[model samples]
Target: MRELRILVATAEAERLRGVLVMAAAQVALGGQATVFLQLDAVGLLRPPIEAPRDGAHQAAGLPSLAMVIDEALGSGVAILACQSGLALCGMSAEDLPAGVEVGGPIGFLQQTDDDARLLFA
Candidate 1:
């Protein structure tokens, strides 16, 4: 399967939403997709808030952040939060949502070792 990997470095709602939409689209097309959240992007891996919590910042016509994440995961997208990011944000692995992996250097290397297309979001 084709693999598409995205490196997320921001926590801005719109930016996060955009990248996730892209990743989820790839998954829907029968391709493998991954999102590696680093730095501020790790914020996306935090526990889900109530419905529409992030809907305000969502792009027009795109799914809510939570919905997009769920769809992507169901479609075999690997969502990862960087270990350094978690520490930097003072969050533990327990703070992350289910199905999200706490990744380190080695894990990052392995995930991108494939001929995956990389996008920085």
Candidate 2:
């Protein structure tokens, strides 16, 4: 493929689940990837242990979002946290990973472009 550059946007639980899977696949396949988490999706980077799963009290056995992020980063994928969403969630840049940056609406632009393969989750 054209050295895949992917951007996934999601704030929904189910959508995030699917997007995570795709991100993992892309990284595993050696694609150049970036995930722009906006809205509630910004909560994903929170200290993973407290990460919610499908919005329930039950513990999800699947690898946490943080693990997926670490894996993606290990494979050279970039993860960005939306500035607006972080403010809405009461989060800050200090709370995110060193690899994650604060991006605004421009985050969306990074996710979708002429050569980028974009997916909105």
Candidate 3:
């Protein structure tokens, strides 16, 4: 199976929606996709709220984002929240969504393995 890895660093809500949409697309195409939500991107996993910035759409308003995240999780997308991000935000493992894995260096290493496709957004 093809492995797809994505690194997202944006905290803006619109980008998060796009990221989720793309991830879902890859999963739908039958490729194994992993999303590493780092930096401020981990904010995407927070309870749905207003857009993080002006002119940005809320991920909650766009059902595709949550749906894709759920789909990716069910299909083994390996969604990860950066450890530093959690600490920086004063969040813990319990703050994340069900099935979302918490990791930092080690998880990132896995994505760099051969046969994996990587994308940074």
Candidate 4:
């Protein structure tokens, strides 16, 4: 079976959560998934209670954004936050959640090009 790798880049907080849900779905179906937090999306790397932005919806019994992120992490989803993204937000490496790599565009490019798919939200 072909591996499914996803590169999700979104600046909007709400949209970023939605993309994460989608990514989790892909993984549920036996696909490998990775998320690249770009621009404002990098703010989400903080712990859920300390998250910078909160636009996630909990209506219709859907899991909250934090829940989905937890699911992704538990499922072994790779999370990358752009190094420049942290700088742009006036944040440091310590501000991010544990295990989130601080890699930029060049690294993202190489990972996605190796038989992986790219999706932007």
* Candidate with best lDDT: 1
Tell me the spans in candidate 1 whose CA falls farther than 4 Å from its real position. Answer: 48-62
| Candidate RMSDs in order | 2.9, 3.5, 3.4, 2.9
The full ranking of all candidates by TM-score, starting with the best, is 1, 4, 3, 2
Off by over 4 Å in 3: 48-64
lDDT of each: 0.76, 0.66, 0.72, 0.70
lDDT score, residue 110, model 3? 61
Q: Could you give candidate 2's per-residue lDDT for residues 1-121 as a string of tens digits?
A: 4334344455554555566567767767766666778867787666642445633423445665556566667767677788888988888889997788888767558556687676665
In angstroms, the error of model 3 at 55 is 12
- State how far residue 34 of model 4 sits from its true place (Å): 0.8
Winner on TM-score between 2 and 3 is: 3
- After superposition, the stretches of candidate 4 with alpha carbons farther than 4 Å from their true spots are 1-9, 46-56
TM-scores for every predicted model: 0.81, 0.73, 0.77, 0.79
Selected candidate, larger TM-score, 1 vs 2: 1
Better of 3 and 4 by TM-score: 4
| Predicted candidate 1 versus true structure: per-residue lDDT over 40-69, tens digit per residue | 778666675333446564555656777777
Q: Which of the two, 2 or 4, has more TM-score?
A: 4
Global local distance difference test of model 2:
0.66
lDDT of model 2 at position 2: 38
In candidate 1 the C-alpha lDDT for residue 56 amounts to 60
Q: Candidate order by lDDT, highest to lowest?
A: 1, 3, 4, 2
